[model samples]
Target: MASFEASVQLNATPQEMFDFLIDTENILKISPPDTGLSFTKKPDKLYKGAILEFQIQGFGKVQEGTHEIIVFEEPTLFTEKQISGPLKSYTHEHHIVPAGENQITLIDRLEFEPPGGLLGFLITESKLLDLFDEGFYQRHQTLKKLFP
Candidate 1:
């Protein structure tokens, strides 16, 4: 399994940050251009059984996936697992931690296994890492700007 985590402190309350993150539509606004991330389906509001279908551009192709919200706790934490996708397995956890008065820490934790074993490892360790690095950076920057 391969894992990646990133966190950013924002000048917003935990509730505020959590509300924004829970909305699937905000993803299109925050994702980096290189990711080419797009949603095929989204729910009116994220819930424990909500499923999100999205596509990512990679290796000159678009890899599509459906992520189900397995855990949902309002204004605090939520975890989603990929039910169908290019990967063998994928799970993501989003945490909203209180930093200070009117401040919060947003953390993204991702665990995944690629499909082709060794080749998948190589690709994930290289290209996928680069893609996520930029994606997370852009996401944080966009969040800060949006909530600051």
Candidate 2:
């Protein structure tokens, strides 16, 4: 069980932030440039029951993942659970909170278990956290550019 959380204040309304998140095309814009995150199968907008198939080839590694949208709340929250991926289990929640009259707070939460049961040495929790830190920093920069 490992977890990562990050929150960024954006100069946009909750609906605005939510709209950006639900758009599949915006993903590549916010993701780390070298991650090469792309969808093999996707929908224009995200909603409960929507499934996503994606692949990333970067950091000197390549991997594929599939996730199911388990929860969707317009202008507020969206959650996805990994159906299959590098990790044994993975869940991500996107929370959009009203920050001010014309602003919103975007929060990202992730919980997962690295591959392997007792011998998950290939990917460590610390390493994952570091990766998340770097990824979110880049994401935040992009969000700021897009929203501000």
How much lDDT does each candidate structure score? Answer: 0.85, 0.89
Q: For residues 46-72, write the lDDT of model 1, one tens digit per residue.
A: 889999999998777898999999998
Candidate 2 runs further than 4 Å off: 117-119
- Model 2, C-alpha of 10: deviation from truth (Å): 0.3
lDDT of 2 by residue, 1-148 (tens): 8899999999998888889899999987898977889999999999899999999873368889999999999989999999988888999999999988898889999998878865367577777789888999899989999888
* Clash statistics: count for each candidate: 0, 0
Give lDDT for model 1: 0.85
lDDT of 1 at 115: 72
- Global fold similarity of model 2 (TM-score): 0.95
List TM-scores for all candidates, in order. 0.91, 0.95
How far is 7's C-alpha from truth in model 1 (Å)?
0.5
